[model samples]
Target: MANQQVNRDFLFRRLHSLLGVVPITLFLFIHLTMNAFATKGADAFNAKAQTLESMPFLPVIEWVFIFLPLLYHGIYGMYVAYTSGYNGSKYSWGRNVMFTLQRVSGVVTFIFILYHLWTAKVLPDGPSFDMVQQILSNPLQYAFMIIGTVCAVFHLANGLWGFLIHWGVTVGPRAQRVSAYVLMLLFVVLSGVGVSALVAFHG
Candidate 1:
């Protein structure tokens, strides 16, 4: 009875930890899709920007919904990763490589996100469509954005793969191998689309 109780408690904790990733992933997809609108020209991109800015209490809402939750999710994710003993070296070679890539990409994404928010959301001058268009017009900014998009997509895909394993969907060795390859392919394609969109952006 004691052992059973301990097992149940462990499972509960894990469930709580794993469940938080779902909403974060959902938001990531939404963000990526929205950003891809940059490919459609300034008018289209600015329309979306105007819509977001036009929301009532926009600043407060952004703090509550975008910044706060993102900070919490990132901290919590790192905690779970550490406590779960998620050492990539113990996994298959492909999984290990993906794991390392995801972590490195996550750091890059974090830096990119901070810069993006600074330039596009939180600056004292307020975000301007003209300013954004000018930034996008730069080759360096385009390169940074392309790298960030690829990193973000791969990180999300790898996280989903890890989620499957956590949920017991990819249990045996063969299934794990297959899922890893499939997710890698999926992320590569998704990243390609995202990079192309960013590269195509014009004022």
Candidate 2:
């Protein structure tokens, strides 16, 4: 029984990690790319928005592909963060940072997502260019959005390393170390794109 429970938990953790990557992280990239359209101008951004928002069955897609996976990943991630043996002091500097940051950013991302969705999706303005611009124009809101973007992006990028490891794809210290550096670069690039999009909207 004890062994079964442990096995279940181990499998759950992998699913939780996997969800963070596939639709969750992939959606992030698409979101950032769409937002990046703002850099070109409002017409470009709004047109792209229209294209996406007009997609048939977008609501279902959002719920099934994006929101469902995110909901599970965030909830399970919070559970694991609280219950796992993730002692920062037990591991080396790399593991220590990964463990601590994973928990911290997971919490931040969870809290931030509600505010983000409320502002970005639930507003009276909908997904229009003016809607995003109006919200980001507020300096405090701008800061919060930037911070939230960092947390969300970092959580995914960092967790991506764990996902590869969990799947036995990147086994061994040398591989993980190399992957960490690569993912760190990915995090920075994604964060830059997200922040830049916000900045464009702010203008």
Candidate 3:
């Protein structure tokens, strides 16, 4: 019985990690790339938004492929974060900081996602360049967005390194050290894209 419980927990955690990288992180990449069209100008951004809006079974797609997975990952991740300890006798300071930030950012990202869905996605008028521009134009709102975007991107990128280790993809100090650098670079790149897209709203 005890063994069974342990196995169940192990599987649950594995699923949580898998969902983070898959539909959740992948969706972030695609969503940010779409947003990047804003940098091209209003017309370009509007066209991209139109393309998305015109997709078939949009509600079904968002609920099944995006929201459900994200909801599970976020809720379960919060539980794990609450239960897990953040101390170690044999880890670098950078690694320790990442572990702590991972939990902190997870909570922040969940809140940000809720606010974002309400403000940008579920409103009556639908989303457009002008709508997003108006939304981001407020200085306080702009700062909040910048923080949310950075936290979300960092959560996704850093969660990826943990995903790899949990899945036994990076099995040793040497491999983890290398992957840490690579994933931090990934975090920077994704954050740049996210922040740039947000700022593009003002242009």
- Top candidate on TM-score is 3
What is the lDDT ranking, best to worst? 3, 2, 1
lDDT of 2 by residue, 1-203 (tens): 89999999888877887888888989999999999999999999999998998899999999999989989998998898888676677666777877898899999999899888877878656587798888878889899999999999999889888888888999998999999999999999999999999888988
Tell how far residue 135 is off in model 1, in angstroms. Answer: 1.9
Q: lDDT of each structure? A: 0.70, 0.88, 0.90
Say which prediction, candidate 1 or candidate 2, comes out ahead on TM-score. 2
* Residue-level lDDT for 73 in candidate 2: 90
Among the numbered candidates, top lDDT falls to: 3
TM-score per model over all chains: 0.73, 0.92, 0.93
Superposed model 3: Cα runs more than 4 Å off: 1-3, 87-92
Error of 2 at 183 (Å): 0.6
lDDT over C-alpha atoms for residue 137 of model 2 = 81
For each of the candidates, the C-alpha root-mean-square deviation to the true structure, in angstroms, is 4.4, 1.9, 2.0
lDDT of 1 by residue, 1-203 (tens): 89999998677556544643645666666666765677777677678867866889976866766677666656655554465544576676765767677667766777788887786666735544467666778888867877887887887788778778878999998998788789889898788767755665643
TM-score of 3: 0.93
* Model 1 score (lDDT): 0.70
State the local distance difference test value for candidate 2.
0.88
